[model samples]
Target: MARTLVIDAHPDATSLCAALVDRYAAGAREAGAEVEVIVLRDLAFDVHLRRGLRADQPLEPDLVRAQGALIAADHVVVVAPVWWGSVPALLKGFLDRTLERGWAYRYRSNGLPQGLLAGRSARVIVTTDSPGWWLRGLMGDSAVRQLTRSTLRFCGLKPVRATRIGVVHGSTPERRESWLRKVSDLGRSDARRTPDAGKAMPAPREIASDAAV
Candidate 1:
């Protein structure tokens, strides 16, 4: 069975992201996949790297364990809202600490970085009130590319993909339902991917199924 690690960045366990986690976990479980989850808000950590790898901020116990979890999972899911067009502080800090050079990646003699976290897949789920068009056109998904390509995939996780749920301020009932189905579908599909093929995994909404949320 595939093993999956879900990093929940939302502060509230009762949030929509948590709902998706529940949905995906359920789907993967039914598909015989083993799943583990880390809720960032609940995990104690320092968001600032402080020395930026010079002195190097010490890893929080939670971060250390979270890194270990990442090392063990076949798939990694990062769920959070976009604060100021980027990831939440909790999630960013988790990455900063957990993905230390020697652990998650390494700089090669040629100046290229080798992704140590190879053989794993990754997904980024972003919740926002920004208009989808505005984000897609103006932002160019800079954050997702940074996290997925320049970061996660850079560290070896394959097929990294980003999904955005926009206009969160007040979505229509139908829209909300659509998003729910989106989550459930993603869960089902994640259940089936090659344990390590996160190479641009499609967002749950993009992988729609007939099932109701």
Candidate 2:
């Protein structure tokens, strides 16, 4: 069976991002995949990588467990809200503090870094207030690059796929439902695609009042 881990990067438990993760997990479970969720806000850990790679910032127990889940999972799904044209600081901090050298990557004989977490696949779901296409066309999709190319890919996760759920602020309840259904379907399709290698989850529909984008 596929082992999938969903990481919620939003600070608010009641956020739309959280709802999306729950729906995605529900879809994955219905498809027969084993799913686990990590709510960053609920965990007790510091977000700062104070000394960068040179500092031996010890991993907290929760972080250790998180790393184990990440290493063992066949697929990783990251859900977060886009803030200031990028991911929230909570998510950024989690990445900075968790995906460290030696475990995530290490310099090889040729002086180039080699990714350690190979054979895993990842999906990044980003919620934004702006239209996705417009954001991509205007701002060059920095969030996607940061999550896919700069982070997951750099750490050896293959074929990182991203989904942008947006215009949340002005969207109607009907539109939100449609987006939720779409994401749920994606989860089902992904679970069925590789049975052993699961696909990433998509963004969910949020309550209009609690919507971010």
Candidate 3:
């Protein structure tokens, strides 16, 4: 069975992000994948790296466990709200501190970075207060770059999918329900695809069974 790691960066479990998180997790779990959650609010770790990784901030025990889940899961699901046109500081800080340079990526023979977290797949579920597509164009997709192109993909995670839930500030109950269904469907699709999600992964890549976590 596929293992999924879900990271929820929201401060409140009753928030819209959490609702989507719950729905997606249910759908994914119902579709036959094992799921775990890394709720950042409940973790005991410094959000800021202090002076960056050169100082080598130690991962808190909870964050370490979170990293372990990240290492073991065949698929990752990240949920958060849009703050300042990007993911909230809670989630970004988790990425900043937990996704250390040497742990997730390393320089190769050609001075190019090779991602070690290959064969893993990921999806980001973002909720925003603006209308759909407003942030992507206005903010120039910095969030997408950080989550999809830069971080997750940089570590060799393939088949990444991202869905944005927008207009949340004034969204009606029906709109929210519709968005919930979409995220749930995404979870199901991802769960269904996990058996072959790593078909395109590089050979000899580390899988959940091979991880020390």
Candidate 4:
């Protein structure tokens, strides 16, 4: 059976991001994939990477379990909100502390970084208050790119897909429901696919929202 890990990066347990996480996990479970969820808000780890990569920092108990989950998962889904053209500090700090050198990646003799977590796939779902066009055109989709490319892919998660649901500040309940269904479908589809280690990373897929700016 496929093992999927869903990470909810929102600081609030009651946020919309948490709802999306719930829907996704539900779908994955319904599809027969074993699903595990990591809610960053509930984890007891400090958000600060006080010691940089140069020094050895001890992992908190929660972080240690999170690492084991990542290692075991065939697919990873991250749900977060875009804050100031980037991801929240909570999510960023989780990555900083978790995907450390020698664990997620290591430098080669040629000075190139080798990813240790190859063969895993990922999906990033981001909720934003900005319109899709404004985020894609003006803001340059920085948040999604940061998570999908600079972070997940850097750690060797392949073919990472992205979904952007937004204009959320003024969105109606109907639109929100549609986004939840879409995400659930994504989870179902992802649960059926096995990660192909040789496949090249494709461009991130954008799931547009209907809410007007």
TM-score of each: 0.86, 0.89, 0.88, 0.90
lDDT of 3: 0.81
Once superposed on the true structure, which residue ranges of model 1 sit more than 4 Å away at CA?
A: 196-213
RMSD of each: 9.9, 8.7, 5.1, 9.9
Error of 4 at 22 (Å): 0.4
Model 4 misplaced regions, further than 4 Å: 195-213
Error of 4 at 135 (Å): 0.8
* Cα lDDT, model 4, residue 178: 95
Winner by lDDT: 4
Candidate 1 residue lDDT tens string, 21-63: 7776776676777889888888766777777887655565676
Ranking by TM-score: 4, 2, 3, 1
Which structure is stronger by lDDT: 2 or 4? 4
Q: List the residue pairs that clash in candidate 2.
A: 168-213
For model 1 the TM-score comes to 0.86
Q: Give each model's whole-structure lDDT.
A: 0.75, 0.82, 0.81, 0.86
Model 2 lDDT per residue over 82-185, tens place: 78779988888899978888788888999987888888888898988988677799888888889999999999998688988888898888888887887787
Give me the overall lDDT of model 1: 0.75
Ranking, lDDT, top scorer first: 4, 2, 3, 1
**Clashing residue pairs, candidate 3?**
none
Q: Whose TM-score is higher: candidate 1's or candidate 4's?
A: 4
Of the two candidates 1 and 2, the one with more favorable TM-score, higher being better, is: 2
Please report how far candidate 2 places residue 149 from its true position, in Å: 0.7
